[model samples]
Target: MPLRASLRPGDTIGILGGGQLGRMLALAAAPLGLKTHIFCPDPQSPAFEVADAHTIADYEDQGALERFAETCDAVTYEFENVPAGTAAFLENRVVLRPGARALEISQDRLTEKQFLEAAGADVAPYRDIANEGDLFAALAAFGGQGVLKTRRFGYDGKGQVMIRAAEDTDTALERIGNAPAVLEALIPFDREMSVIVARDAAGTCGAFDVSENLHRNHILHTSTVPAGIGPALAETARAMAIRIAEAMDYVGVMGVELFVVPSPVGETVLVNEIAPRVHNSGHWTQDACLCDQFEQHIRAVAGWPLGTFERHSDAVMTNLIGDACDSWPDILRDPSARLHLYGKTESRPGRKMGHWNRITPHQAGNGSSGQKS
Candidate 1:
């Protein structure tokens, strides 16, 4: 079934994961006179603090899910790795934004690449790795170089290894727990960029400015808007995002990561990964745009009109990983800096503690100015 009407004020929205994304979504909902119910098995979920209501139960707890679903006018998830059974149960009971198909495709690398290609987006060459023999053959074909990644549950450099030689294949497979994986041909390219796009039930699409990203230790380090990719390349990135959203009939905000590589004709982009929910790369929108990605996602799921994604400033967003968030005082001292801290204690290495956005007056003639994609 599809959404036939919009949700009204005070309606409850259920979220599947209780992380910072869910917390921010709940925060975005309050001003719209909406409420949120967070459901996660973690007792100390960061979202649990901000949500109006919450249920601490496993995804397989049908009884708990039933009670939670009945309270929500519509439902959306914060993460893409939702249990198929859990998503199926919710889909039958209430509206689930981005739907089951989006969840299924985004959960696996092989399926995601195929979907991107069919959607008319360029993607790197990749092969499914079912065994040690398969991995070795794929690596050999790719010039003894490729990225071996688990098909599911991999993020922030987890469940991934670089296969630079035949000798590295055994250890690479062992690192990923010998799970089914995909070996993608290495893309020798320029910078990394991502486009954040939102699609409503009525098929209206809105996309934010492109973000030029930097990564460290396989985790995102910074996302700078305007991407400095010039107008043509920027438009190409956004067009690719729109095509993907239309292809998926996506009903919420999504992040489309890309590799902006140099082609024979000119600089072009290849779709690297698709995140079915609000992305870390789009966090800059919170401070730069009038209507940020979180709000856009909520509007789409609730069947409301999309908001303005126009930016008034050029901004750089940096993730405060681990204990780096301890410098909140210095960050607060900077008048142009907007700090956002995820309410999580015990920050360990590689953990995403929070992020801050530094905004400056928009400079004109930089390719993206007063343009809404």
Candidate 2:
């Protein structure tokens, strides 16, 4: 059955996975007068601090999951890796936006790549590798040097090993714990870009401006809006994102990461990966756009019209990872920076604790001003 027309203020939104993403989602819901309930296994989940209610239970805890579903008007998840059965359980009782099918396809690298290619989007050439023989075959077919990524559960540089002609296939497979994997021919790309697109229940889609991403150690370090790509390629990136969303009948925010390759006269983009929920690359929109991706997602899942993706300014968003957050006081004193802290207590290395956005008016030269977070 289709969801009821609209969710009024005071309606509670139940979110699975409690981290910075869930925390931000809860923050966005509150302005609309909606409450958020967080369900996560971690007792110290940062999102639990802001949520109106919370349950510290495993995703597979049926009794706890059922109670959570019964208490909220609707449900959404912060991460794509929520156990499949957990989603099935909640969805059986409540409306889970973006749906289980979306999760199933995007959570696995192989499935995601196949789906994008089938939808007519260009993706890096890849082959499935399950064992030593398969790896050898893939290496021979792809010139011996490539990225071997675990077919499931890999993200931000984890679950991946580089494969070369000289490397032992048995050693590489053991490194990844003998998991199913995919080997892709590494592409020489000029730069990386991402599009954050939102779709409402009616299937109306809206896309934000392109964001050029910077990665360090396989983790996103910063995202700059108005990616220096030519106008034509920018439009192409947006269309690819919209195509993915519409093809999936997606409801809520979806991110399409791309590799911008140099074309004859300009540049062309190729799809890299699809993130089925609000993405880190769109963090700039929080201060620079009319509707932030978090709120846009809430609106979509709540049966409201998708919000505008128009940016009010050119912006740079920097992530505060681990010790990078130690300079919080200095960042806070900067007037040009809009700072956001994830409310995490520990300073683990590579952990995304917060972000700061520096926005400059369209006509401002050299950027508006450096605002400290």
Candidate 3:
């Protein structure tokens, strides 16, 4: 069942969601002598520009999904929001990595928290919110402070509301359109970090270095390598990521978002969320390590042996959100900066246009200290 035997040169891989991640995956595949076919509803998808072939049709269109599945040796998605029906259709035909169960678990907030906890991971206290009354009781249980997030379709601060006081609950449910939700106690985490782990067909696992993340307006701003955490804690994070992957029989690169919270005994690492596919936090690995995350993912899905991801230098990867990409000309002037721009024609606030990584030769005894350029 390990689809490893027939992946020769020029095999076509089908990718769902024609976005920047898909574009990066296609770019990575070229060196391995692979071709990519992109499938998405958007005709103007940026990935369409780089992929070897593409199908522009809605995910619900059975005819389109059938045609797309026939052309690829393996199918993987760039985003977790991929529809369950579409993934199932592809799985019955071609090979699908990090399969439908991974998408199903990550697509719902309540399910994700439960899955992580069952996999022996620490998670924040939470309760399902099916109605306004549930929200009131759950928020009160967390001492009048909790974040209410919709169980489905929530990302980048969307479909969520922060309740800081009793008075703020008046229209909290209305804000998210009264969708099924979950209320989580907000932990005053010391630092936000993430670990990207790859699990191949043989169940072998390897994790990239931790990234100490910084967010602005609920969007990731930068990820600095050699996270300020100690080595032992970093290992704990890596082990946690591997456990989660094995629990789901996951194949491909997955990102595990984590929170470092201080406790009386020591710093408690909590599972913040899981990304079923390649992630934003792992962008730093692209320049810092020889086997970047995008390529690692391609290798895993293609059933090739995973590569080493050890970094030779410290790196700071900053996401160019919205109009921030407008300064590309200025940013590219730095002789050492590596710039990556997603080929999107229009830019709006909070849109992730691209990113750039600045690396310095590894400094002895000062790996964790870094800032974005």
> Pick by lDDT: which candidate is best?
1
lDDT (Cα atoms) of all candidates against the true structure: 0.92, 0.86, 0.88
Ranking by TM-score: 1, 3, 2
lDDT of 1 by residue, 1-373 (tens): 5644589999998999999999999999999999999999999899999999999999889999999999999999999999999999999989999899999999999999999999999999899999989987898789999999999999888888997776887799898999999999999979999999999888989799999999999999999987969898998889899999999989999999999988899899999999999999999999998999999999999988888889989999999999999999999999999999999987999889899999998888775643334
List, residue by residue over 1-373, the lDDT tens digit for candidate 2: 5555468899999999899999999999999898999999999999999999999999999999989988888899988998899888877888889899899999899899889987888898899987888888888888877888898888898999887665555588788889999988877899999999888988788888888999998999989987877666777888888888888888999989999987686778889899888999989989988789999999988878877776778889999999999888887898878999999999999999899998877543322221101
Per-residue error (Å), model 1, residue 308: 0.9
Model 2 bad stretches (over 4 Å): 1-5, 168-170, 263-266, 364-373
User: Where is model 1 more than 4 Å wrong at Cα?
Assistant: 1-4, 369-373
The ten-residue window of minimal lDDT in model 1 covers: 364-373
Candidate 3: residue 326 Cα off by (Å): 1.6
Clashing pairs in 1: none
**Residue pairs with backbone overlap in model 3:** none
RMSD (CA, Å), candidate 1 to true, equals 1.4
Please identify which of the two predictions, 2 or 3, would achieve the higher lDDT against the true structure: 3
Listed per candidate, the RMSD to the true structure in angstroms reads 1.4, 3.7, 3.1
